[model samples]
Target: METSLRYTSNSRSLKIHAKEKLLVNSRTRLQLHGELDTGTGAPSYFCAMIRYFNPEALTILGLGLHYNKREKLRCLVRGKMEFPVRTGVPVTFNVKGRCDFDQEFNQRNPKGAAEFAWSVMNFQEDQSVRLKVGYEIFEKVPYMQIRENNWTLNANMKGRWNLRYDL
Candidate 1:
């Protein structure tokens, strides 16, 4: 179990944040987090979030929910899967998405990304360093056009090579 609180103030805004997390199992965790911001000229709002993380089979799953007066509500989901190869290492595929809830199912704001990566070395809990390379795409759709009660997704997709180091 873990808990924390933070408070910060600037010339224009003051912010407060708190978080609590509990380990449900060896590889599973549940958390609750919240934040509040208020000040002069800044729109005051409070946001709360809940998250869960765990490993299932050859995949890692993550789920979350965010709520606030500004955005109303949002949901997030992510999955990472590993496939064994002949080289004795595994290649990983990851996909993640976060979207705002709208009364109309076809019209929504969505942000999504995906990656395919493989580590240079076998990952281990005691290992201090690792490198990974992957190709990734990030897409965002802020507005959907409603035509004749049907909606279409308007998004821009950007793709790039991603190199990451973990220590």
Candidate 2:
């Protein structure tokens, strides 16, 4: 369990979050996460998740809502697979995607956007220990009157790599 409050990047709003996780069994778990941001029409999020896991694979499914609106619903699915190399090193691959839809206030056509991300992480005792390389793509979202300008799609391409250390 965890709770937190923080100011947004611009310090224009306060963000509050509460989260908890339960280990249902040796191979399954559940989580609930909720957040609220104080700003004009800023949607609050509440998400519930279920996950199944083993030593070599994991899968997760989540459903979420914004401000309790049916139109402000979203879903996420993610999976991870781990394989052991002949050299005794282990590498893991993870992929996840999320989508959101609009109800158009019951007036206009419904539209939505999606994003996908994937990463490969190699774990070795030497040579950088743990390293991850990843890429992400976001569907282009057009400018609409009610849409937030900050969400405009301009430079959507992204690639990232990270090195992890326990020290």
- Report every candidate's CA lDDT: 0.43, 0.45
Structural RMSD, model 2: 10.1
lDDT tens digits, residue span 57-149, model 2: 444544433333444554444444444333333444445555443444333322233222222233233222223333443433321111121
Lowest lDDT 10-residue stretch of candidate 2 = 144-153
* lDDT measured at residue 14 in model 1 versus the true structure, 0 to 100: 41
- Cα lDDT tens digits for candidate 1, 1-167: 12222222222334444566666776666766665454433333333334444444466666666566666655645555554444555555555555555434444566555544444432344332222333334343222211111111221223222111111
TM-score of predicted structure 2: 0.46
Cα TM-score of candidate 1: 0.42
lDDT: worst 10-residue window of model 1: 144-153
